[model samples]
Structure formats: structure tokens, C-alpha cells
Target chain A: MRSPTEAAAGADDLAAMFGRHARELLRYCTRRVGPQLAEDVVAETFLVAHERRHRFDPSRGELLPWLYGIATRLLRRHVREEVRALKQVPHVPDAGYDDAAAHRVDAQRDVARLSAVLAKLPRRQRDVLMLYAVAELEYAEIAAALEIPLGSVQSSLHRARAKVKAAMSEEDNR
Target chain B: MSRTDPDLIAVRELPPGLAEPSDEAVARVWHKIAARPAPRRSSRRLWVPITAAAAVLALVGAGIFFLRPRTVSQPAFTTDRETVTRVIGDLRDRAVTAEPVSVGPGQVIYQTIHVV
Candidate 1:
């Protein structure tokens, strides 16, 4: 068993890890979901990471892959909840921001377009793409983070990449 | 062009532009975790049951004392109806005595006096 001092050091290391990577995690969340909910999702991801630090393998040279995995799962849940909520609401005209100039329609359009494409992908594929493209995890790291076989990671990533590319090309053609 | 060709690569992997977490974010998280009080000492929590039992015992003793029936002064009487009636009659016949009698369910005479 680790000594008390060692355990405390471990906890501090976890905190330092989170302090280092939280912003990137937030950006990934913003890309997967939107900017408005990114902070909450990132905070929740670190909370889980802190609570589950015992599960981490220190032998891994880096912690970002695991942290990204956690953030990916959280973003998935956030997006699903958002989509479910949207299904119940009627569409309405966009209101001007309280400041009237900051809430650009272009930003809203981009968010809407991304949301529509993300909502249609399989959950596994979406997770793979988000981790690889948005969070930028390597294949080996993604495999370790997801706890899946290496072969599975490669195939899933390939399928996810193909889907995202097709969707982007289709949007461009229109 | 083949889909995987380098020149036709539609998706570009940008350099990680991640910045350090804001001081405010770090401080907020650290403060929350640090402010959590240590687990209560086992000795203190162990005293809870013992203290509770002692309190319960004291309350029960007090309740028994307060709720116990009280002794009140009451006049003694004979059990024999015939003897009681004879004695009552004898007293009534002598000295023009007046004795208390029950006139209603809970009401009683206020005075028993002998008058000449």
C-alpha cells in the first residue's frame, strides 16, 4: 500500500493534470456540444477523474487521453439531453442578444449545422471522431482510453472519418 | 483522386492550441476540494449512540415520575349496604341531624349539620 505522503502526492498530481488540460478539454467540449455548455461539461469530467484516480495507469506517459475519454462521454450525454429537449420545443425566431450586437446569427447557424450532423451519427462513431478529430487522441491512446481492442479502434476511427468527410462534402455541394 | 491522397486531404489536424486552465478555474476547484472538512473522528461519532441511549433513559425516568398517579385523601366507608343504611338512619333520627346525599351523578350535598 502507498504511504500517506505518497497518496497525497498522487492527489496533487491529479490536480496538476487537470489544471494543465482543462482548457483543451473545454475546447473539445465546445466543438462537440457548444460553447455555452462546455465549461460545465469540462468541470464534470475533472470531477469524475479526481474521484476515479485510482483507476488510472501511471505507466502511461500522458494523462490527456484518459481525460479526453471522460470528457467525450460527458459531451455525449450533454448532446443527447439537448437533442431530447429540442424534440419537445417549438421552433422560434432568434432573439437579439441582451447587448444586441454580440449574438451573431452566423455563430448560431454554425452551431445548428454542426448539431444536425452530429445528431445523426452512431454514438460509437461520434465518440471516436470527437476524440480523434476534436480532442486529438492517437489511435493507441484512444484504444487505451476506451478500453477496446486496438483493431476495433482503427476500424471505428476509419468509419467515423469517412462519415464526417462525407457529411462535410455533402454540405459543400449544396 | 484517391480519398486517402495527401493533397486532397479535406480534414486538417490543427496544432493543439490549448492554454493553461485559468487561475480562477483552478482556484475555484481547489478551494471546493480543500474546504471539504475531514471525516468526523470515529470517537466522536461512536459517542452518538451512547449519548442517545442515555438521553432516552433520562426522558423515560422523568416521564414515569411525572405521569404516575397521585394519592388523594378520601373518607373510608363500610362495604355492607344494610349496615350503612342502618347507621345512616340512626344518625338521621338523632338530634334532627342533616347528612349529605348524592343528588346527581357527580354533585353532592355541601353540609351535614345537626340542628335542635
Candidate 2:
């Protein structure tokens, strides 16, 4: 506790960072991969974040983006696993929702199709789109996270969305 | 969903109940790491009023670090770059592909991230 270096990384800073964003990052990891691998991915993310906590420039952006960048890097290690799980489209977590119609929404078919389209997107586009739609990250946050220019973030999101739309439309017609 | 872009609709339909890591999982992760290493000089600050302002934006009990500042600088954080970089370098090596994912969208973006 008395280490001169450790003082820079107060437990409050690490705890503050983790307490603030762990749940959201976990859920994002779960959706990207699945529950089985999600914990590993999330755990690795925090471990990396903790080690790199010093490199984190709060002035560069909020911590979530940096966390996402780390999480995304970890996810890349298991991209094959992620693709496999997405192909399965596990049952929606909220089984108790009131709407019978929600149950009938054909999530399996749609997610499977989306997964395939996502597989084909340029890695940047996919990253941007996933951060935008899935993580609900703002453009600036994504720019910081992905470390691309703000313009690139917007363009990648646009391209990614267009490609996804095209692919989904193809599925609908089929 | 049908009325929206099919892609948007499909993703939007995703239920929010994704499973999260348990506290036990978090503890195990924490146990893996030893003490925080030495600190290198970093270009960040924690102006008190900014921290308090960032806290006010909290939803529930959660608060985030607000990168934007309305005040002058505080102390530069001493970061442990050597150790951290090695750890991430290991991660990059362990990665399935040998590409730098932290910076992508090509060389321009990669250089920009490093330069900034």
C-alpha cells in the first residue's frame, strides 16, 4: 500500500473504474460472444485495463472507450469462438417478458443473418458498428476507443450500417 | 422492427438481459494481478470541480471519469508504460491474428492514435 507507484493507482481509482463500467462491458461482451466465454473476455479486459490503467488518458476520453478498446482486443483473440456462438443465437435472456409477440420476433433467424453480415464487414466497420449499435457508444467515444479520427468513426458506422441493411434486406427477400 | 431498417430492427430486438460476470469471477481476476507497478509520467489531471461535476452525471451509484475539463491542470500521473506495454504486447501476440487491433481502419488511424 505504501509503494510510491501504487499511490498513483489508488484502490478508489481502480474500483471507481470497475464499479462504474463492469456491468455494461460484461453485457456487451456477452452479446458479442456469449455467457460461456463472456466472463473470460470480461475478466481479461479488466486485467488489461488495470495494468494499462496508467496509459489511460482520461483527457483522451472517458474510461469506457479505453475499456472497450481493450475488451475488443481480447474478443479478437477468440473471434472464431465468437462467430460460433453468434451462429447459435442463444435464447433471449428475458424469457418472462409479457409480450407473446416479442417471443415470436424470430430472433434466431435475424441474429443469425446479422452475424453472417457482420462476419464480412471490414474489421473497422464491424468494430464501429458494434460499438455504435450494440454498445451504444457515441461517435466521439468510439473514435477514442478505436483510436480512429472522428470522421472515420462516422464513415465506418455509415458503411457498416449500409452493408448490414443490404444483407438483412437480402435475407428478408429470401 | 419490420418498419425499421432490417439491420437496425434485428439488433434492436436484442433483449437486454445478457448475463454478466459474477463477483466471484471479478475476485478471481483481481487475484491474478499483483501490485500496481511503478508509474511513468502521464498527461492527465483530476481537477476537483471536474471530478465532482463528472460525479453529478452518474446514473444510479455509478460514476465515470470525465475526460473533458473546465479547470486548469493537476499533477501529471506517473504511468508504468514498460510493464503495461509488455503485458499488452503479450496480448497482441496471443491474439489469433498478428494485427494491431487497438488502432485500426488502417495506417492513417494507427499513426494518428500513436501521435495523439
> If scored against the real structure, what TM-score would every candidate get?
0.50, 0.55
Clashes of each: 0, 2
B14-50: candidate 1 lDDT, tens digit per residue? 1113243466754555555455543344797789999
Error of 1 at B85 (Å): 82
Give the CAPRI rating of model 1: incorrect
lDDT of 2 by residue, A1-174 (tens): 134344334423766666667777876777777765766777667767776776776556666778898888788888787666655555445334567755555455566667767777777887787787778788898888988899999888788888878877776785
User: By summed lDDT, which 10 consecutive residues of candidate 1 chain A come out lowest?
Assistant: A84-93
Off by over 4 Å in 1: A1-12, A82-114, B1-116
**lDDT score of residue A55 within candidate 2:** 79
For A1-174, candidate 1 gives per-residue lDDT tens digits of: 445455444544756766677667766665555444666777677777777776777565256777787877777677676454323223335656765543544334333444455566677776776676666677788887777878888888777666656655554564
TM-score of model number 2 = 0.55
* Candidate 2: true contacts recovered, fraction: 0.31
